[model samples]
Target: MVARERIITTVRPLDENRIRGSFINCSKGEARRLTLPRLTEIDWSEVDFLGWRDPKAAHNAYLVTPRGGEVIGVALRAAEKHRSAVKQSMCAFCGTIHAATDVTLFAARRAGAAGRLGNTVGTYACADLACGLYLRGKRRPAVHNPVDRAPLEQRIERTLDNLARFLDEVTTDNAR
Candidate 1:
C-alpha cells in the first residue's frame, strides 16, 4: 500500500500587509496593536488561515483569510458564553455541529460608522476558528460522523466558501 501524504498546501500563512489590510473597520492604531501568532504556536501544515484570541484582550479574536494569492485579516469581538455547558452546538462558518462549549459567539466590527455607531455582525464560530482544520479532518469533532456525510474535499470547499462569504459581508458593509 502506498502511503499517501494527506495534506497538500492549499493555504498559506499571512504577512504583515495581508494582516493589516484585512480589516474594514480597524483603525491604524488598532491594527498596530494587533499581535501576530508565533510559528511555534501553530501547525502551519493544517490551517488555511491564521486565527487566535488575544492574550491581552480576552474578548478579542482575529482571523486572516487567503483569496487567490492575497490575504485579509478580520477583527472580532467575542461574546461571553453561558456558565452552564450543553451537549451540542453549531459553528456558523463551518456549519459543523459540536458541543455548546466548542462554539463561541464572535462579533465582527462593521465596516464603517455602523461599527463606530455600535453595530456589529456576529456568528457562533468555533472557539479557535479551526473550522478548516475540522473540515479537512486535521481535527475531528467530539462526536461521530453522520452516515450521509459528504466527501472530504467538498466539506473543505464548503467551509472555505463560508469564510469567503463572511469576508464579503464585511467588505460589503465597508463599501457603504
Candidate 2:
C-alpha cells in the first residue's frame, strides 16, 4: 500500500478549466482536446501542484500550479522514455536527491512562433512534478540531499524561483 503523505501547507485544489487556461504555449483548441486526469483519483492533500501525463497521449504532460492565488497551467512534452539505474539523482526544480528512475526529463515548447519554429527548453524534474510535496516532506528524498538544509521558508522560496525561471524559458520572449 502507498503510504499516505500529508501536506504541511494549505493549498486549494483547481478545476479543469483553470488547468486548461493556463497554458502559455498551446492553442485553445489543443488544450480543449486533451483529456484531464481524474481529479478524484489524486491525493489532493499531498499534492502542492496538480500534474499528470495523459495515458492516451504519452508525449503530453500537464501541470497546474497555484502561484500567488492564481493558477498557472503549463503544457509540456515529455522526452522519450528512458529507464535506468543510477547512483544519485537530484531534481532540477526542488533539488531533492532521489533514485535515477524517480526523476524524468521534460522539454517544454516555447510559446507562440518560437514553438512553431520548434524551439524547446528542457529540465530534469521529479517524475511526478511534485517538488512542492518533496519540499514539504510529503515526499521523502531517496538519497541524502547534497545541499545544506536551510529553513523551510527559504527552501520553498528557492524552489518557487526555480519554477519561475523555467516558465520564463518556456515563454516566447525567452525562446532561443
lDDT (0 to 1) per candidate: 0.71, 0.73
lDDT, residue 18, candidate 1: 62
Model 1 misplaced regions, further than 4 Å = 1-9, 83-86, 145-148, 174-176
Residues 1-176, candidate 1, lDDT per residue (tens digit)?
22222222266655666677766668988988877677566776677667788888878889876664556677998888787646788887777777777789898877777677766777788887887678766777787655427886676666676676676666554434
Give candidate 2's whole-model lDDT: 0.73
- TM-score for each of the candidates: 0.79, 0.77
lDDT of 2 by residue, 68-107 (tens): 4566677888877666656667877778888887777888
Residue 100, candidate 2: alpha-carbon lDDT: 81
Best by lDDT: 2
